[model samples]
Target: MSHVYQELNPGPFERKASMMITTNLSVLINDVLKGAATLLNQNWAITAAVNVFIIFFTVFLYLNTSTTSDQVTIRSASNNAFSGGNTTTLKEIVFHPNYGGLWKDDLALIKLATPANFSEGVKSISIAKSLPKQGTNAVVVGWGPKSYFSTTDGILREAVVPVMNYETCKQKYYPIFLFTDTSFCTAKDNVGPCPHDFGDPLVYKNKVIGIFSGSFDCGSTTYPAVYADVTQYNKWINKVIKS
Candidate 1:
C-alpha cells in the first residue's frame, strides 16, 4: 500500500479554464531566459557572469486573490489517513495570472502555516529539476472522484500513468487549448488525476515532476489528464523556498 499524505474534497466547481498552468510566472522567467540568450549570443562569458547576478538578485513573489477549488492540507500517512493525522493550515498560496487569470498558469505553491516535522511516516519529497521524458512511468495520488459519476473519496487514492509526448498532447488538445509549453499530459484512462485532483503532485523517481492541472473528463484515455511541468517552474519554486 502506498502512503497518502494529503486529502481534500474541493467539491463541484467550474472546469473550463480552471486548470492551473503558471503562464503568468513563466512569462517573467521567459524574459530572464531571453535576456540570458541575448547575452550568450553576444559573449558566453559575460552571459554566465550576468546569470549568476540575476539569480542572486531575483526575488519573485506574488499574491493571488482569485477563488479556486483547490486546497492544501497536510496529514499523516496512517491507515486511518487524515482522520488520525495532524492537519496543517495554509499560510499562503501563490500562483501566476495569465490569459485573464482563467486557465493558464494553473500551478500554485502552498505554504503551510507551520513547518512540518519529519517522522516515521512523515517525510518530504523532492521536486524534479529536469522534465520527465515521454513514456516515463509516474505515479499520482489525490482525493478526487474515481470516475465522473462517482463522488469525491474521503481517503487518498493513487494511479500509475505514463508521460505522453508533448507533441501528441498538443495535437489531442489543440481545439480545446491544453498542453501548453509548460504543461504535459499522461497516457491511458481511469488511471490518473480525475475531477478535483487539481494540484496533486505527479511523482517520478520519488520526485515530483508534474502537478495535476486539468482534464476534459474523468478517465478519458484519449485526452488523459494535463499537468503543469514542475521543471518549467523551478525558478519560481526556488525563489519562494529561498525567500
Candidate 2:
C-alpha cells in the first residue's frame, strides 16, 4: 500500500513542506532503523557546548558551521528575562549516536566548563526512566517564538499537552514518515513549541520524557507534535555520562 504524506512549513524558521509517496513500508522502516544505528555510532566534531544541568537542550538549539563550543552559552532560572539568569559556557557536546535525519534519538549531553550553582530558580531535572503513557498530561517549555508572525520575546513559556497514542500517531504519518520506537507524539492543543523550540524538554511528573523534535504547523489541531522519546535512550545516556 502506498500513502501520500505532506507537511507544511510555518515560516523561515520551520521545516519546509515536502510531498512524499511510498509503497514499501518495510524497506523504509528498515532503512531508517539501520541509519540510526550507523549514525549513533559516529560523533561529529562541533566546538559548541552547553551546561549538563540543562539536560538535552543543545540538541535542538540552532547550530551552523560557524558555531563553536565557546560560542555556545546557556542560562537558567530566568522566567521573563533571557539575560536574567545564571550563565555558563559549554565545555563539550556528547550527542546521541542514534540521532538521525528523521529526528529519532534526537538528544545530546553537554559538559559545562563550570558547575552550575543551584538556587531557588536554577535547578536540575530528572530523566524519565519509563515511557509516558497515552493521555498523560505533560508540560513543554521553551523561549522560542510563539507563532510564525511573532519573534521571540526572550520570555520562557510553557504549555500542557496530552500524550497521544503511539499506534494512532504512527498511522497519521505512515508511508510518508515512519516513527521509530525512540519517538512519540503529543496532542495538538493550539499552544505548543514553535520554530526555534526544537530542543525544549517535555516534562511528565517532574521527569523529562520527550525532546521536542518537530511539528507540521507548530501546534496544528490536525497534526500532533512529534518528540524524541528520552526514556528509550536512558542506557546510552547513562553510559555516556559515566564515561
Best by lDDT: 2
In model 1, the worst 10-residue window by lDDT is: 36-45
The segments of candidate 2 whose C-alpha lies over 4 angstroms from its true place after superposition are 1-68
Best by TM-score: 2
TM-score, every prediction: 0.65, 0.69
Task: For candidate 1, give the lDDT.
Answer: 0.47
Give model 2 RMSD, 1 decimal. 13.1
**Residue-wise lDDT of candidate 1 within 157-178, one digit each (tens)?**
5556788856778787768774
